[model samples]
Target: MKAAVHSRYGPPAVVRVAEVDQPSVGDKDLLVRVHATTVNRTDCAYRAARPFFVRALTGLARPRRAVLGTEYAGVVEAVGGGVTSFSVGDRVFGYNEGAFGTHAEYLAVPHDGPVATMPAGMTFEEAAPGTEGAHYAMAFIRVARVRAGQEVLVYGATGAIGSAAVQFLKHHGATVTAVCGTAQLELVKGLGADRVVDHTAQDFTRDERRYDAVFDAVGMSTFGRCRRLLRRASSGR
Candidate 1:
């Protein structure tokens, strides 16, 4: 099996395509022939071991294994003894955070781990980034407890995560206001944001109105600044 092997942590140059032994299927596992994968911020962070805290999972001295990838869209080539959910030749897309090696021709994961049947009318590459975006956006919205008729603001509304956040918040019934640059205002509005604030042109905090939740999707907004944008009863860290 050909894979992107990483012997060291640095840049994309450090990742080499090499022939490695194909992984064996364990009980309750599915052996997948990876068709596509996404290179997200987490992949880059793990590859560079940025922020040092990420090294705690990869390794302090070096990476545990060279292959770096997470979200995968692929077809199952084989299945293990206890696997009933999927069989050979089923199309699927999902995330594998710990066992991050989906950038190869073949990879194996437990049948129950984030893996799910691909949605109707979706392609592998299209589903690849969708899974990752959905996961993070769902996580934040869950934590925030956004509700219908409540006003919520998502900063950085045009980013990969931001775009997803806008839709997720709307899906959860929140009246979402998206913050982005002027160039991305239309894109944010199309994603279901009720209002689009051009961060370059206007400061959202200066508005007299407050919101139930203020999500700094880009981490570009300061704690004090965002806090001021929140209503007194809904302020949260």
Candidate 2:
């Protein structure tokens, strides 16, 4: 199997495509012939050992795992014994998460680990990148306890997580306001944001209206900066 491997962490240049031994299938695992995978911020963060603390998991001086991709869409070529959830020829998409070994021609994933049949009408390329954004957005939505008719604001609303947040909030019937660069105002609106703020031309914090929740999807803003935007409880206290 050929995979993108990085023996040491530094920059994008450290990664190279090389042939490596394919993963062995465990009794609960499925051997997949990878059709598509996505290189996302998590991959870059691990590769660069950014924030410095990530080295605790990746490695102090080098990466623990040679292969770096986290998300993949592939077809099952062989299923290990006891694995009945998927079989040969099944199309699946999922993330490896902490294990992190999907950037290859073949990958072995446990049948029960985040793996799911690809939705109808979605291609491998389209489904692979969707998981990263969807996962983060779902986490924030769940933690915030977002509900229908609530007002929500998403900052940096054009990137992967931001765009997904806009759509997810809108789908749940929340009135979503998105902040992005001028070039992406219409793009964010198309994702179902009720209002779009151009971060370049305007300061969203100056707006008088408050929201049930304020999500800085890109980590570009802090809770202190957005506290004024969050709705306050009534009773004039």
Candidate 3:
């Protein structure tokens, strides 16, 4: 199999697609023929060994895993003996963290890992990049304690995290206010946002309405800027 590999951490040019040995499938593994994958910030951080401290986990000297992808969407070419939840030819997509190795022609994912069957009618390309964004969105939403009927604002609503956040927030019964560039207003609205704000023409922070929570999925808003938008704590207690 061929993979985008980097022996030493550096720029994008350091990674080169090269022939590498295929992963051996253990009893609980699914050998997938990868059809699509995503390159996100996590991949870039690992590839460049950014923040310096990631080396403590990835490697002090060099990356322990040469393949740099963290997510994959593919069809199962084979399944290990112990695997039952999935079978050969099943379409699946999954996410991994430290155990990154999806940027390749083929990948072996654990049967009980973060993997799941692709949603009905969804293409591999759409499902490939959805895992991480949905995972992170769920984490952040839980931390925010979003609830039904509460007003919430999501900045950068066009990107992965923000887009998923909008849908997740809506599913939680929160009234979502999605902020994005002019081009993505309709798309964000289609994601179930109750209202869409084009950040280019207007200032969302200056809106008279307050929210139960404000999610800055793209790191474009500081807490200080969004503080005024959040509803104040009840004083009765």
Predicted structure 1: lDDT: 0.86
Candidates in order, TM-scores: namely 0.95, 0.93, 0.92
lDDT of 3 by residue, 1-237 (tens): 999999999999999999999998999999999999988999999888898998988899899999988888999999999998999999999997778889999898889999999999999998998888888999988887888988888988888889999999889899989899998888888999999998999998898888888888888777877888888961110
**Candidate 2 lDDT, tens digit per residue, 1-237?**
899999998889999999999999999999999999999999999999998999999989888999988899989999999998887999999988789888999999888888999999999999899888888988899988888998988998988888999999998999998999988878887899999888889888887889888888888777777888877751110
Top candidate when judged by TM-score against the true structure: 1
lDDT of each: 0.86, 0.89, 0.88
Model 3 global lDDT (CA atoms, 0 to 1): 0.88
Position 93, candidate 2: lDDT: 96
Q: What is the lDDT of residue 108 in candidate 2?
A: 91
Off by over 4 Å in 1: none
Please give, for residues 142-181, the per-residue lDDT of candidate 1 as tens digits.
8878888889888888877789989988887899888899
Ranked candidates, highest lDDT first: 2, 3, 1
